[model samples]
Target: MEMIYRPLLPATQYCPCNWQSDSTSLHSLPQSKHASSFLRTLIAPYAPLWVNSTPATTDNSSDDLECPQANINYRSAFEQQKREAAKKMDATTLMMSLYVPKGRWQWTYQVPFENRPEEDPVTSNRIWSLSVRTARIYNESITYICKLYPREVQWEGFFSEVKLHKTQLRPLHGASTPALIGIQSNITGIQLAYDIPHHSFWIQASPDMPDILKRRCLDAYHQLHAQGVLHGNVDLANILIGGDGRVQIINFHKSRSTKNDPKVHLGLATPQDFNMEMREVHYKLNYLGAREKERAVWENRRNSRQTPSRRTTRRRDKDPYAIPMEPPTDPVRWLIPDNWKPKRFIVPGQSREQFEYHLRQFLLDLEKSKIHSPSEGDKSQGPNRRPPGDRSPPPTRCDLGKRKRGEVDSEDDDDDDDDDDDDDNSSSKRVRFLAQTNHDDGSKGKVRSPPPPGVKRQVPRISREYQNFGESPKTFAIPFISS
Candidate 1:
């Protein structure tokens, strides 16, 4: 996932808005270094530090550069990213600086979580714990999610295990990223951070672990065959869940089938149809058959025998700035009304990368098993019993300690109460995602945003389509959240 950015390019260099490239092709980059440099110079007043700082290393393989252990490298990248993000005062700041230069669509505005009435669970024997939401993932080019935890007893390890898995549909919104998020400790609470606008996403752990992100995981699998990339997990929660039932996907399609680890089991698997690219690299090393001439011949025969790219599969002659299409005729259309929408960015506050991991397991099922699915492999019946949380990394801080019985006090006394609703904890459904209509006028219209965090906590259940045959328990949202 870190490799998504060319090693030394600044954030603007690989900005999505600069040019819309075929999502499946690595060769179709959005901008060149020279163009990016010019864009940076123009926007420097709004952004002082958004320039290329990747050390000029000849290695070319970011994977080999002390990735997991290189805490210093990760920290350096993060600080640099932060200095670049401070210019965002309002929508125009991002539009002029980040989105336009990059050439992709830019989506902004707080999602339902902004109104969540609750605070992170406060407790000092807290069997349950929640990670700090970074307090600042709202803006940033880099993101980090922890993936390890240790419990005093293995049973704590078990339930804590049940707790941290992003697969379970706990609609609790906090910090998360597109590629990965997790922790490895007995403590059940862990926090993650990410860059929503950038296609390149990251988590602090597992080069292979990013596959577990909700959106990327499922999206990667959904188009595996067309992209010449193999799809792995394809469950509902594995991808980003939006306000209007739209789903966005991620997770590297290049490395699923051959990469499963025998020791971790995680109950993860993929459908059989997924295939890797002939020129793909894995774990920073190339894994295709050796001998360039023989490899070329092999790919030719392979491409000849496989299915042709589908009509639904869209490719571009040159990089386009956005996903374009004629306006859809539907009067109820939220944004542009047409099949011409560019792929939607994963909605903020929802974890799509996590869903992809679960979905990969499902995709393999589609390939290996003979089940018929409503979509890809939706099961008509209840899901097969599997381990809870589908092999998520253990929680590094899995407990919220103990909370007082009186902790559920009303929020009428809180310092800030703007648009805050006081809901009877005993009654009211949790709003899972945001839903609203907006005109180009930028007026705040009616919105069905989620309840505040203080309201009765809603436990998210994986959509039935992904419970088993789909197997991804990640959150799914309303189809259109962007305006």
Candidate 2:
């Protein structure tokens, strides 16, 4: 079991939103020149003294430029509201604005021990110990999460993470991972701020977890490896699911860079480190899916055992249009007459009445086309029937000679009349015969007999038969003509 740290120091109640120039919320904050610029920008509107005064440089040996000392006390107005109006306030009221671009932070004090929810035991303890809270920048609307660490236990971890963020992890800021805001060091502890989205949450496995999200998580790891950074703990807790469906990697305290870390560069297993992290991610994702599936199975079993009929009724009541999973006990309950049309047949992007109107129109057009179609007697003569006035030339000597030589098959000669009768009909046998004849003529360089003058070659028609209704619909072949 992991040891949970509980800080003895009381949680800070200071909120940046209420900070004023004369306010003493911050005390003796030691920041580098780079961090000072960011700090100045954050407090410029609230603290005129810090902004107008010359910035202090922590990089140099000089101590003259250090920040002014102010009396610090933790007393949050929000915390007071939670204490006074716990019942009236919604639990998610604070979390709702977490990712909202307020250009400012709404810092809520840490959860009190007595009021902490049972579900978030670790969260409360961690927040209390780390002094983790939200912050607001003077002119910045983006919310930033801040974490304070005891100088003795977490200072080393703080500096290591900051170095990686400023170096190899810099490019991944606001993309695959949160961007570091700045760092503040005082005699008490070290504080590191980051621009994490308000809507970001830790990864949790679910049965309906999208494969795209899993792929994104894998891609994030690949990117980290490509940057020569190895996240020592590649667990699910360290992964964040963003509001925009992006996967973000966090908690770089244990991360190492092969480029920056001498130990990583010298290690023989360095190459396998990247592969191991990738495998771990895949395994964890698969495990989460399996766990969720098992949980669902258990829930279904419990529900079925408790109230099978009630559940079924509830499902039917919720979605009346939903298809029944099980057949009705009495067939008459579901069976409908051939002419009957369900009142609620749905068509997407259109109303039921509009869809029904269009369907009736289609059926009317189909009926009209069938009535105007060629008669059976005319169809039996083939669609290629020539006009009565047109006449064929008398058989030439060359044609008579070929016929006498038995070039044409006897079976074809016998079926000539029958083939002509069925020429308008769509059948597989007729299609095959035409295809075979074409193939043979092409391969053997045999020229087919020429057609009568003014007549064209046969064109296959697009025919579709609808047999979904009680009776089969007649095949309506529409001949496709080339442009």
Candidate 3:
């Protein structure tokens, strides 16, 4: 309950408009164990001083095999690695169809998701360092990870609009997944980057791979709700294992089609890139506000892509329990702390409208030796803007860092940010989340929103920014079903 994270400095100067200004080119995705000089920089740029946990890696035996004795488990060694990924992608697309080699697919050692370089877990001291992405798969890839899943569930019943019941026939219901008619891009079509691999998991390659790996995320969430369409970006990195029993659910971008009945893939273009990753997990758990906006927008978009996320750090990256400032009350992903503080502004060539808020208040006082060390009754509940020394960092490992805030009534809706809803629909009665939704005396129900649950409400300005890039960034939807 002390949130305010903003740590990312890959050699400073600032970098996120997209990152990747050709740093010796970029390469490390073809099977990626993780080294090419640690991907070139920020493997885990001190994972934002812990921010409430997620930097503990001692994990080795997900079956353990480094290279031979093929017992298998990365979901059946990924279903014989997806039938040998179509025979090694048909002999490497027939040896790149005999082409010479022009950026081959743009692999010039492209560093910057914080410098990179962190894939060493075979011998002993084990080092992962965090910083993931590359999970593409239909063609061959798998490593995508953005972080900030501090919690999930209840973005209005996980993609709400009142049980989603759009009918006209509901796009004729699941025509085979794909929608995005009409394209317009101020850029950002996957290039926010990562060419694809949004998700893929069917694994069968063997030794029971984590019980058939979550049975392919509950059989792709019951096969996208039996194809009426509403997978609305399921979770655990959109679920993936793809090798044989192919239990998959790769990103339809945001997938909807509950019943307008055009047969399913209405037209297809991107629907705003599948509603920005199914509404960016409903604004980082909006109902809980994306569990602290995925921990302050991935620590401010990966610390503004510490030089385009080139990421780096030797050992001491610390995850003592990451406590940045927000997320930890646990009533299902806590988020009403109310301490905000830094909201000054003025970035135009940095004449310094307070010099980036005193360099973010001297990195929030050098992040008090880095917190997230919480536990002993959460350090007698003492740490606030987190500084006074070791108060958290001891959770993330296996359960994968602080997760439980899931099962709510209904709370997942998207489109996200750039919003500004005033709301007053004449006594209101809108529930249009289309998938099957039909309550209010109709059928599928659940509707109530009053800051009740154990009571603790305050967080109102969920978002607001005006650095003036020509001005325009307000976003506020908040509509997932109520009356």
Candidate 4:
């Protein structure tokens, strides 16, 4: 056989070596600094030539020359490992970021079965199952007890039932059934998420509960029945007893509309039909021997109320307006203070000027009462003075217009009927009343001239018919002012 020479492996491959024998040597190496450091750590356990104290020879001289070349090989392998690790870390981070974030109104989660409580009744149920998960929403941490269905058809049916409950029954008041938030499905099964109520089931019999609780439960059943929902599963587990002693019926998956037959039956009847059975049970528990007598009496009374005699019908027809009438008085009149007098009404034949004078006097009296004190003498005596007697002539047409415009600056001796300059406050009040009454006249009441600055123009108080009553040929009776 021909002798063949096999090139020996480099020492750096089998044993650790200071690839950077000198600072200049390391800088001159083609491999990167990171690759060099990685290769050092990977071969840390291998004994170096310096540690072994091996003698230098011709065979070892070849190993020294090959060290840089071996380092390049090691560096490539190290870089490949780092690249794979970084790719795996980036993939894991991206998966974690894809999870659904929390929300305001509602939230959901895919929880594992291992998360459920070991002793929960849901874990023991055979026909139906549930998985528990926590959801933070609406500023509350709600523990969602999601119902799990095995088959696709079963999940579809449950979803339909919940949708019906949400749309048809949720809008009705006192329908205290737990609301469905959303549905989730996966390889394991389908889950129906509902807002979990923090309450235990109302397990006690109707007779065992207090009269109030019994009535409330009965009322809830009635309401559910009236809404056409038949709580097909009304067992102790389905009835929830709230912390505040409220009773809520839940688990509508087995429930049915009055118009449809239930998919599953647990011997529970529709609310309307169930009421009669409940009544009998209640009578048997509490009224014992008086059931028949009480039923007979109730039937007799109901029949009597339902059937009206011919004579009674005739009487009702003869007096169709027999409803009781309330007295004509202001409902809020009693809320007024006792010291406040009723508003003064105009006398039957009172003239417009007389009514105005009386109104001014009333307002002045109110002002005096507000400022009056035992120590203060009457300050009613001033430049704006009213005549002591009613003998003073009524206001003329020109004086009324001048007063309305706030042009009466001084006491006019020429016109005895003119009011004092201080009467401007009273004139403004009269103008407000006129504006209110004349509002229906539209453009007819619009002011042609603007009043002077700081002066409010008087609005006509009388209606269109009364605007030119003095010029009309016919005499019209003044409208009555009722108390």
Candidate 5:
């Protein structure tokens, strides 16, 4: 593909020099020799586009001039050299050059032009580019992600990121972030070494993701933070996970190093202030899990309500004249009887099993009382003494007669009512026992009414004075004795 090179730096800052046949090739330049010549062979096929600072001879005649005047003259000469070099970068060379700075400097290796530079679709950073092809360096094919700063952009971000990649991220290479391959002037190359197809963490994020995968992604960030590098943007889109289960962080254009406190660049915050990146990641994961779980519960309830009964479906299919009925919108309200009320006696803050266990124990106690027979000593102790299970004793004829005579006197009626209250309490206990028994039997219990007039009994009554005054009256005992 045809490559276009826009001048990234002004002529004063960077001077582009054409490759000369008489001059030394970039590969033959005196620099640190690699253990292997693979890098030299890689760049051998591509023509050299630019060269670093060309050495100049100082004229001894200018040494006698004033210090300020001589410095001005030297600066003017350097600028003149840059302008001459800029004129050499003709239209033909501009169309064929890459976006790298105007220098033939060698880094870890050399990259030959495979395709033109394209804007990186994945990066959140404003300044980013992707080479349209991969480079097989040292027998390993790598996806080359490039950081590009054109002429209009500031060079601080590009230089700082390169410093971070070459220094802070060196130890974490191939583990957390991508390894820095090399840089050419305005463009930097890093190795995205994953073998399998990958996607951003945002695309595959789910509450249902395996615990191992979540932990792995989180651990990758911890590893990065340990290197004293803070990823200012801890977004899901910046994290990459491969199909082969590898997790790696990317887009370090916004990252900062706590260890290096150089002059602040590009209005970026300090590393200490941005330490919350790890915390943000953790909270986001928890939010996703909770949100998904709640959604699942709601969906389950809706599906259960929407599913029609098989019997109803069959009936509708068989009846030709049957009218189609829509499902109830509020299923709970439709399915429950109108008279059904919430249970007032249900103990709050208890699980279903706990409530059921306590209720069962109460019923068991009632059953034990019902099965107990009266002891011989208790039965023979006194005529007034009844069985152990009985609470109120049957009143004698004499007591009933005295109570009835007492009711004749209006002042004495209160005393009679008080005495009857003890018997009423005993009757209530008997009713509760029957209710418990009925509960165990799965039937409704009935409250027994007072017997007919032929039976001897003391029945509760309301006083006439209290009733006439329109106030709640006390219970009066009625005498009914039969021999």
Candidate 6:
């Protein structure tokens, strides 16, 4: 029997057939005939056909074997083409539905585009074709982010940013900031790719962040400022904090570069001509001012020993300057002490700079006062006068020890006796020294004393000369009546 094999059907269309044949000994039949029958049974649905004919070995080997090989090659090529076509269709469908580029970044379409309700009608109506979209991506491991943006928005600002990030800001790769990866512009739309950060900007205000991380955020801003870039939108939402405690400044589409045109405003309320450094200083000063206000409030509460009401606490929760109640454990805490009171100067119609200058002066004066002023109890005393009861001991007489030794000559003894007699008299008199006063009336250079009972008192005249007599000076008054 001669066997005739039909062309194989496509893999998708092929099916198996159930055929039960009785077990028969085929050893009596020819080898070729037995092989053909077994093959036909094996492929019953699309089996080879057997015909009674004389078998020609040479022609069969050349024509039949070559034809089957050629057919196999053709079938493989057709299937490969079909597979390639299906893959392309899938990619096209994904692009159309999700509006994202293919390869490496598979869009999960989980996060929706956010639009502020407070936006103006013109701004609201202006379709934001280039929106952030979330995607699941794996470089070494899987990551999720909403950092995708469309490239073909036909906006000059977008194109400028694309060029800037690609050329100048290339060194910022793998940082907390978004780095440009790829751009695809086709009939559908433009797609600008970026490396997604691990954390979003919304988590910056979380109380769980350590002081070190907050400082890192400040450092990131400084770094950007050093690069002559001003982050026009410097809200908390634009400052991203990564899982590794890394900080990044993003949303640079509205950023202004001092290296470029300094006059460009870039949607910020700051002066158009201000450089990046100036803008950075302004931000720092504003932050310091807000911190001072918070410090003042905390100080007042602490001094008053009052706990914030629930309503006040809730109100403060919405305050942009509000910080964690636990004091910061960093060097910056020293600069913004909880006891610090903001003595900002206010002039009714003064310019901002003038007001700030006055505030600076107040701070300087406060520091000076801390250094030079006396304690609270001693402040009432005049500058020259020592505190009461802090008098120095009376001057010791040099001859006092010699007088007590009893070794003096007669003349010395007489003088010593006279001095002893004067000292004794003065001790018994109970004299008190009072401050000299200037009188506005005609009676000047006169010491007044309280009159004793049944005695008229007179003002004593000032005397410049001292007499050798054992008598008290005219300025001194004796209460006892002398006989």
TM-score of each: 0.20, 0.33, 0.18, 0.32, 0.33, 0.30
> Could you tell me how far off, in angstroms, the CA of residue 74 lies in candidate 3 after the best superposition?
32
Clashing pairs in 2: 13-74, 98-198, 99-198, 99-199, 103-140, 103-141, 104-141, 105-136
Number of the top candidate by lDDT?
A: 2
lDDT of 4 by residue, 328-351 (tens): 122222122333211111112223
Model 1 regions lying over 4 Å from their true place:
1-132, 136-177, 181-233, 241-247, 250-256, 266-483
Candidate 4 — what's its lDDT?
Answer: 0.42
Better of 2 and 4 by TM-score: 2
Local accuracy by lDDT, each model: 0.28, 0.43, 0.31, 0.42, 0.43, 0.39
List model 2 lDDT by residue over 1-483, tens digit each.
222232221111211222233333323343345542222322222211011245577665457567668765547766876686764334323422222221122232222111111111112123223212433233212233445565456334454566677677877877777765555433344455555532312223221244445556777887888888888766554565543445677777667777665422322227666665554565456423433333444466656643144354322123211122221122222222333211111111223333323333333444454455434343322223444454554568987885565333333345766576355432433343333343322432234555789999775543232212335465544556454
The lowest-lDDT stretch of 10 consecutive residues in candidate 3 is 180-189
Give the TM-score comparing model 5 with the true structure, all chains together. Answer: 0.33
**Candidates 2 and 6: which is better by lDDT?**
2
Q: Order of candidates by TM-score, top first?
A: 5, 2, 4, 6, 1, 3
Per-residue C-alpha lDDT of model 3 across residues 223-327, encoded as one tens digit per residue: 455545555544433343331223344333344554532333332323343334333333322322335545554565445542123233522333222222222
Looking at candidate 4, the ten consecutive residues that score lowest on lDDT are: 320-329
Summed backbone clashes in each candidate are 116, 8, 128, 1, 2, 0
Better of 4 and 6 by lDDT: 4
For 1-483, candidate 1 gives per-residue lDDT tens digits of 111222223333433331332332222222455543312221121111122345676765887765565346778888877765553334323222321111011222221112112222211133323222222223332322222222332323222222222332112222121322322221232222222323232111111121222222233333333332233323222234222222333332212333343333322334333322211212111111112323444465556643232253223222111111211112111122222211222212323332232223333443343332122222222223223345444333322221132223343366344224334421232232233465454554454555688897455644334333434556655342232
Residue pairs clashing in model 6 are none
Rank all candidate structures by their lDDT, best first, as comma-separated numbers.
2, 5, 4, 6, 3, 1
Model 4 root mean square deviation, Cα atoms: 34.9
Give me candidate 2's TM-score against the actual structure.
0.33
Superposed Cα RMSD, model 1: 33.7
